[model samples]
Target chain A: MSALRLIARDLRLAWTGGGLWLPILFFLAVAILYPFAVGPDAKLLRATGGAMLWIAALLAALLPIERLIRPDWESGFLDQLAVRGWADEAVAALKIAAHWLSFGPPLLLATLVGAALFDLDGDMAGTLLGGLAIATPALAALSVTIAALTARAGGGAAGLMLLPLAIPVLIFGAGSLGPNSVGAMPLLAAVSLGLTVLAPFAAGAAMRALRD
Target chain B: MEQRQAEPAPDAVVIDRLACLRGGRLVFERLDWRIARGTLGLLTGPNGAGKSTLLRIIAGLLRPAAGSIMVEGRVALADERRALDPLPTLRQGLRFWAAMDAQPATATDRVLESLGLAPLADVPVRMLSTGQTKRAVVARALQSGADIMLLDEPMNGLDKASAALMAAALAAQVRAGTTLVLASHIPIGIDPTTTLDMAI
Candidate 1:
């Protein structure tokens, strides 16, 4: 019940901060623009549908994460939340899950619509959503861990530093629908979950560092 | 003054051979401290005496490099993850962790008319001022049903009036057989019952 309350509190904070809209705009706009920058030809755009959709997702899913944990860390609530008796893994899961609910699903839908507009293959849409379903939690968990690691939140450069770490998700999420089998997508998912569980320990330690 | 037995004497907290090093800087080296039953002990030292670090370790919120803490006749923090016992997690109710700093926690309110916080019963703990926060911390120590309370600087950041309230609350707790190992510089108004100079 308290976990839900905390999650609800996070959602309320996210909503007031327009966390949803900024990413929504960025996701949609970038989805619309990247193909044109690469090439104006519709044929090239059509050919690149799967890649474009996944890339847009990776970009969109990641943009808000830079700001994801700043408030909680700054507020001193992260350590307090840890001490609240919920298992560390459970707390980590709830934070990542809430983050995904607010940011991931909307971006997925936006990407699906973008894919349809671009005449991307139907199976690739399935891949986009499925891969994202597998990967969004991973993205959130990894971001939380990295943010916890850096401790000094709100650094714009930190997000960029963390982006390369998600390349596997970008790779598999974009290519999982390929003619050849994509075995590594699930592997990417596993790594993300592993990070989620382990990140809390680091986050707890980082918080000790922060307290001083 | 002879037969003063209100609440039973709780167990002591034993911290032995505790050492901690952060980034190669030794905070403490083989420090040993023992907090007895029902005594209000103060932890004092200069700026870097590692008072908060020691408190965190005692609270089972952090781990010591080489040492152990036992409380209530049991290993207090055998595993960094475990406490005196996994003090039952707050399932649903009002709680006063640091989060309340921005969330408005009250430390006291009269009966008959309650605010939007029945969950915060047993004595208000949300919407509290600094002294009130300390008082609430003590109230929580009482409510926690824990025999021993580990308070860090129980008097810092509190005004004189709030300090009196806190002192009274501490007195009440100590009188109830609740031991307090507090970290503070300013007198928390309790007759300096006991003091442990961390600088030593």
Candidate 2:
């Protein structure tokens, strides 16, 4: 019951706090800019669009990183919940789930616009959608972990820490869209699942460390 | 009030040889104290003293470098930070904690009334004055129905009437068998049964 309420609170905060539109807007901005940057050649746009979308999705996930855990930490919400018999791990897991819910689906919908803008064919579009579906949770997990790690120090350290760790996800995610890259999809799924499982523990440890 | 399983000890908290270290400096060492249930226990100290640190240790939010604390009941804390969603209405913010604490729906109203914040229920938390925000944090702690509340500077920003209200509400909690470990720099109205002076 408390778990659901926690998720509800997070969703409410995300929607009402005005960051819900940020990632979507940023995603579309990248989508709109990519074609202009590459010139309006349909073949070039289609060739590079999937990779561009992957980059956009990754960057979109990064947009809200600062707001993720810092506010709750500063406001003493985390301490209050701890006193209420909540484990840091459980809180972190719930946050990751909530973060993904707030981030993943909206970006997925925005991807449709990006896909259309890029004039992606059926096969490429399907690959793009599938790759994102498997990848965004991992992206969400990464963002949350980075948020916890740098919740105190601010955004500079977060970018420095997150970008390096995110290389694997980015590699496999973009690789899946390459022609005849049958093995890349499973690798992406594998890496993503591993991150999703480990992120809660990492983020939880960061919060606990912060308490000292 | 929600019923709790009967505790064996008359004391809600027992601190033995407690020590705290922050930033590689010893904040306090070998501190010993007992906070009896159904009484107000005051933690009074000068600035840079460890009153807030002791409360955090008692609340289990911070680890003590040495010694152990045995807390006998559910604990709640209302510190300098409001610990609430600033965007939500005061009532909505309190209701979230109430729900988390597993208190009934009516608990929010009752707590607000006790804290003299009923009129501010519909106001957004960010719009509240300093004292109102302090009262709201107290309201959140009180709504939890915890047997022990560790409040850091509960009366910090209150004016005379609001301070009186806060004192009255805390006294009422003591009368109802709730234990409070309060850290305040100012002398408060309620007569604390025991006072731990950390400055020494």
Candidate 3:
């Protein structure tokens, strides 16, 4: 019951604070500009658009990381939560869920714009959306873990730290779109499940360390 | 006081030779104090005397370098930070915590009224002046309904009237069996059961 309220509060704040828009804009900008950068070769756009979208999604995930945990830490909201006897792991897990809710579906919806821009055939677009659906939980998990780690020392290096961790998701998500990749989707889901399960513990430990 | 520490009541906070180290220096050591239930305990010391550190330790937010503290009940804290959401109106910001604390719908208004924040309940938290923000912090701690409140400078930045209101509210809590250990450089307008001078 308390956990649901926490998530609702986070979502309400994210919506009201305009935290959802910047990353969506960044994602769309990448989609809109990719053809301009590489020149409008229709065949090339079809082949590489899925991979480009994956990269754009990964980068877009970073836009909201700085504010994810730092604001609560600075404002002493986390301390109050801690005083309520909330385990850090529980809080982190709920935050991951909230972050994904606020970021993932919107990013997928925005993919329609990207798909149109890239002139992606329906099959490729379907695969990209499916892949993001599976991969976004992992992306949300990774973003939150990094946010908790850097929340105390400062968030300046969160972006730099996030890219390396995002590689596995990118590999499996983008790889699943290849024509001959028979079993890649399951592998992507497996990785996402592991990350989604493990990230809360990692973030929880980081938050405990921050208390000292 | 030392004798009371020797034989602490079950519903009391007993610190036994507590020692704290912060930033590689020993803040305090071999400290002993006992705060019985319903007692108003005051912590007074000059700046850098580790008063805030001691409060955090009691609240279980910090680990002491040595020794132990046994607290009888759940704890809450109200420090310099208001901890309320800045974007929301004061009432909405507090309702979130009220929900978190499992308080009823009426609790937010009740605390706001007690703190004399009823008028500014519609104001965004970020726009509140320092004194109003201080009261809001207390309002939050009050709303938690914790048995023990470890407040750091709860009276700072308050005008005489607000300070008196705060003191009265805190006294009422104490009378109702909520233990309070507050650190303040100035008098909080309540007669404390015991005052621990950290500078010693």
List lDDT for all candidates, in order.
0.59, 0.90, 0.89
**Residue-pair clashes per candidate, as listed?**
7, 0, 0
Q: Alpha-carbon error at A211 in model 2, in Å?
A: 0.9
Query: Which residue pairs in model 1 clash with each other?
Result: B104-B127, B105-B126, B105-B127, B105-B128, B106-B126, B106-B127, B153-B183
Top-TM-score structure, candidate number: 2
TM values, all candidates? 0.72, 0.97, 0.96
lDDT for position A8 in model 3? 91
Q: Compose the digit string of candidate 2's lDDT tens values, residues A1-212.
A: 99999998898888886667989999999999887788989999999998999998998898888888999999899988898889988999999888999989999999988999999988888888999999999998999999999998897888788788888888998898888788999999999999999999999999898888
Q: Give candidate 1 misplaced runs (Cα > 4 Å).
A: A1-6, A35-40, A66-75, A81-87, A152-157, A177-212, B1-10, B29-31, B65-67, B73-146
Looking at model 2 chain B, report the run of 10 residues with the lowest lDDT sum. Answer: B1-10
> Which order, best to worst by DockQ?
2, 3, 1
Candidate DockQ values, in order, are: 0.11, 0.88, 0.76
Best candidate, lDDT: 2
- What order do candidates take by TM-score, descending? 2, 3, 1
Chain A of model 1 scored by TM-score = 0.84
